[model samples]
Target: MVYDFDKLWNYNKPADTEMAFLKLLPKALECGTDYHLQLLTQIARTQGLQQQFDRAHHTLDEVEKQLNTQAFPQAAIRYLLERGRVFNSSGNKKDAAPLFEQAWQLASETGNDFYAADALHMLAIVASPEQALEWNLKALHLAENSADTRTQKWLGSLYNNIGWTYFDMADYEKALALFEKCLQWNEKQHHPMEVFIARWSAGKTLRLLQRTEEALHTQTGLLKEMIDKNMEEDGFVFEELAECLLQLNRPEQAKKYFAAAYNLLSKDIWLQKNEPARLSRLQKLG
Candidate 1:
């Protein structure tokens, strides 16, 4: 029986995903050594995503002991990618970059366009701003040209990454354009959460471009849509709405949203660890 690892992933809930992967281990083992090792790599990835870097490394280390790069090349690629992710998430981009590069090279040589694009996208995350765009564009082009649907599925994320790359470069127009493209792509793919995120990105760029009214409209629409869909409230959406309201000189309305944003976002472990100042500002504003 062929197991689909993608079915086990829930990126928004890494701890739950970790448990799901652990439960699948027996089935994976019955499949074969290759499937087992590949599954182990993903277990390590969940650990990394949850900020358990040491545990993630240890998990990858166990996988490495049994990994034969020639016999299990796909597993080897996954191991490299997961290990690199642990390093990158732990603030060791210098160590992560070489592993991502190696994975890219190996995957490309093995005709694994999906993993190749994955490696390049990881490279973009660790690279400098100037180099990040280069990596993202390279990954985007590869995904666009690949005949493999798995590889082609990377296009939406690539578009979002490139949009943020442009956003960080302070080219708001280009960022907005790419984010709009991301929105369209996600809509076509029927990924509701991704479409929401893409809309948020585009709205944020509008505010940066000094189109405050339009930004406010966009964010308000998103908030209404989320409520209408009975979706969980998004802190980022609240944050954006606060910013838009503040820009429009509505301090009382902004304060309410700011407080809501802080209440939700302050619970985010990654933000608490990496962006204390941002949280502080939100608290003060609230």
Candidate 2:
């Protein structure tokens, strides 16, 4: 098969970006692409962005096949990052979890601040509170030592997410402190999405602390901005906003937001791919 005229015959049809990459993979070694692992990952991400998990995995398969022959060792961090993301986005945490573990070890071993921070950020999200706090702090440490703007933005969001985790654990003071740090870092970086996340978390933390007046006002303003930005249609953001409203003794407003969330999520055909198991839940929400 290695010497065949068309070793990747099935992939030659170019039915999709994944296949095109697959077809060229055999000769990738002969060419100048040491980043084929990254290439497979890039294509997979494009598929993932399109919400096509099956295609993303199919591309990942090609990457695994190429690695079996001889992989470019330096690209492992990027490869694992993409692999973890594909697994996570597809809701296969069981499968995705190991990728994060691998990525964490690889990044630490290589002393790559960017990849290390990213790996830690991902691991923190799925970890238990104790473990998450450890990872989040490590990510913060790495970001602090790096001069990369992108790393700062990611670290800021990680802080906010860590704050959220603590909030869920009913540690309002810790959540508020972490969220304040998140806001400070994000403000310096100027990332609006991270700012939004920070604000939402802040409102929640404030509500948990019984700062109802502040929470209500902040959330009200944030909701208006979300609506204006058209982000009210995002299921996740809608859920966040709804939680805030519900806490403010505004169940009716919460229901309206949840109903809108249901409507937005019901039409999410993108998530439908490779997620039939979620359809029932989506339907219930709808």
Candidate 3:
């Protein structure tokens, strides 16, 4: 099993990942039909992540034509998972759920714990708010107990998802605890960006818990760290800083950060489409 597709993926830069997979296609073809088909599934995934939904579907269609369920079940599982992801990412969750369900069942039956966990995580994303926690917990349990290191790598993300679910349910304390756990997991894994994201999650939860000073400290530290590391400025960090300042009755200081946040976050296509109200509020506040 020379399935090293993970090395080609950079979830934040889907276009780059797509190109990487495209470059690897010839090599995959030489490996075997199973490897080729599985690689195509990942290419489709990269396309989906880039919002190239039609192209992704076409790629998956090609994979399906060569799929052999009996001889290469893993490839089949990958195809279903990628197809479901494309539908889910395109806001067609209604059609996506069954594909993920099938993937989950097939992956579990095949003893592919990694894809089974992936399917469960995707299900958590598409599930109703009331059912999301259950799906996330199921995925988390599977990942935690898996002997496979790749499967266990899901723990940080699972913790973050569970934390957000709790946050949405108004269980701030629980959310904070889970976010802290996520932070610890990422730190242990030595994933710097994931650790930073986890810290951001915890900071936001702190504000919601009325720990204003602590939240302010955390956001300020993140801002300083980003500057020191020469990392791209995150609008969410600025937004959190502004929020903390506002909560402390320092409107003047808050306004500048709000302006900075809006200037950057307004350029986000997903935020523009899905969170217009939030952007509008930032605009008005700024």
Candidate 2 has what TM-score? Answer: 0.72
Q: List where candidate 2 sits over 4 angstroms from the true fold.
A: 1-31, 49-51, 68-71, 147-150, 227-255, 265-286
Supply the global lDDT for candidate 3. Answer: 0.93
Candidate 3: worst-modelled 10 consecutive residues by lDDT: 1-10
Residue-level lDDT of model 1, residues 31-140, one tens digit each, is 89899999999999999999999999999999999999999999999999999999999999999999999999999999999999999999999998789999999999
Higher-ranked by lDDT: 1 or 3: 1
Candidate 3's residue-wise lDDT over 1-286, tens digit each?
5768878789999999989888888789888998899999999999998888999999999999999888999999999999999999899999899999999999999999999999998898999866889999999999999999989988999999999999999999999999999999889889999999999999999999999999999999999999999999999999999999999999999999999999999999789978999999899899
Provide C-alpha RMSD values for all models, in order. 0.9, 7.6, 1.3
lDDT of each: 0.95, 0.70, 0.93
lDDT of 2 at 56: 79
- Model 1 regions lying over 4 Å from their true place: none
| lDDT, model 2, position 28 | 57
lDDT of 1 at 126: 98
| Candidates in descending lDDT order | 1, 3, 2
Clashes of each: 0, 0, 0
